[model samples]
Target: MSVRVFVVGIGSGDPGHLTGEAVAALNAVDVFLVADKRAATRDLVTLRAELCAAVITHDRYRFVEVPDPERGPDAERDSTAYAGAVRDWHTERARRHAEAVTREVGDDGTVGLLVWGDPSLYDSTLRVVETIGDLLGAEGVTLEVTVVPGISSVSLLAARHRVALNRVGRPVHITTGRRLVGEYDDALGDVVVMLDGDLACAGLVETHPDLEIFWGAQLGLYDEALVRGPLREVLPEIRRRRDAVRAARGWVMDTYLLRPGTGR
Candidate 1:
């Protein structure tokens, strides 16, 4: 019996952030798997509650929490030691989630995973599913998976900040903090950088201090904060506010859009 899994993105902690189609699909999911509930936890519960509040089929949903991959001190290192560690962690994470699906399905059953933002975006839930799918396929557990897209953090950020992602006749590059820090060979007209740890804009201005930045954190939440200016002035404030909030909340979710030189 083949296992049918639906990978659905629930947006950034808000049911209102979800699209109509996404909400419908979420309401239709039989079993829901939420990753990293024990660690970086409450938010997932809140997210689930939000989803339930939006949909009428609350009682039909069965939720499972899958442990997230370890993000430790060595997570950022490029050495063979650290690389191996990260790979092992991801593999283990995938294995556990796959095992859960296998055990739960036992034969033919449908399961759904709630991913933050769009699953096809920077989210790694799909990658985990891919790894686990291959593992299960080899073990004779046939798997079929479908992904339902939600409003991306970038799109939310744009709406919140009232900024266009790309200029009239230009292009925008959407990338991660690591890529922003490493090398930007292409000319950046307008860019929205996500998965950043607040140092992304700083890195850009450390070399050229003339860039403009529009930054925001907790976009759809009450604690949302936005700062826009030259990177030199804005970067420090972003770090300061981000650290304080992180310390207070135990977690933070943020995304920023930046442009070289000038942008409102």
Candidate 2:
């Protein structure tokens, strides 16, 4: 049995972010693997459903809800433990996806996995598909993978702020909140941080008072909010607003860019 998988990037929470290529891919899919992990992120599942409903005109496509793997305390303690936990989690997820593909989709049929933002940026759907292929290949299941790109949160953040991601000919360093704690250096040019549940920018601002920050939460959504100014001046308000928004909505997906400069 041959299975074809389309890892489609649906962009950041907004249906309008879907590209022409993504819409075409949606029409080609027979099954959509939706991840339902936590109550806080249930809205993300709903948004994917809405995207399908809005773009997919055929009734041939169906959704298969997959329970995501849990990343426990191992992900919080250290880098080694965190990497191991993530690897284990992805392996488990690949097993689940392989079963779903073989049972839910017919031979030669195409399956879709709706990824938030572009698959190339901080998303793991492509890696999961590769794992699924490896697992299923032993059972005589051949796999073909296709990636459809969509607007990334990084692009949306820059557009919303009306600023370039880099400074002149300098490079843009993209990293996570945890890494920013120890790896951050002003000499690294402009830095963009994501997956920051801890508000690392608040702490960094204390040391680098001249740094400027452009922060956005729930980018491209109706409740999207952006804050920008000197890190020292805006960090407190960003924290307050982020907390209030998260409390009201149960979750928040935010990204920020930190540059070494004074506020305009």
Candidate 3:
């Protein structure tokens, strides 16, 4: 019998974000592989369990914890170090994930990985699952994977801000916080930035002072925070509010769109 894995996107932070398909997948799961990330992410894991309780009709399913590996302090400071750390971490996670599957579930059992936001985005769960599949192949077992899509933080940001992501006929550039400055261009029209823990736009305050920004933090959560206005005028407020939300909630996820020529 083949192993079944469902990669379900649960959307950003809200149980209400689960679609009908995601709900169905939740019920189908026999075991949910949850990552015990860190102290700051404890709430995140709780949120998943809460989501499952709120959605699934049966209590037969259970969670199996995958002890996540640390990437080291310097991983965030340097690009090369960060890449290396992430690769090593994923390799280790794959091993642990495979071991957990082998020990807990039978070959025909169903596993669910609840991913935050869309799997096709910056998330690595899909890639890690691919590695898990390879490892399971040793026992002549194959994985039958199913993916259920969820709304991304970028989509939630645009919805909350009530703005179109792009201007009339122009394309919007999507990039991470680290690469935004280099990718920022008037030709791109609207640039959507994500995975930016440092508020990288702050660096563009002087150079692109008049640029309009529609920013949202913890999108869809009860305490969601949003900032909109000139990049220079509202940036400090964004940073302050962002820090406050992170302090109160142990973590924060934010995304923004940079528009040229004043508020599109």
Query: In order, what lDDT does every prediction score?
Result: 0.75, 0.88, 0.88
Model 1: CA > 4 A from native: 37-40, 74-76, 79-86
Predicted candidate 3 versus true structure: per-residue lDDT over 1-264, tens digit per residue = 588999999997477898999999999999999999898879888888988999899999999889998767741567787788789889899999999998888968999999999999899998899998898888677899999999999889899888889878889889999888766777777999988878888878778777888999888877899999888888889989999999999889889999874544
- For residues 122-159, write the lDDT of model 1, one tens digit per residue: 87777778899999888988878888888787888888
RMSD of 1: 2.4
Error of 3 at 246 (Å): 1.2
Clashing pairs in 3: none
lDDT of 2 by residue, 62-86 (tens): 8999888887874357888888788
Clashing residue pairs, candidate 2? none
Residue 238 in candidate 3 has what lDDT?
93
Candidate 1: residue 236 lDDT (0-100): 77
lDDT of 1: 0.75
Candidate with top TM-score is: 2
Question: What is the overall TM-score of model 3 with all chains considered together?
Answer: 0.95
For candidate 3, the per-residue lDDT at 39 reads 88
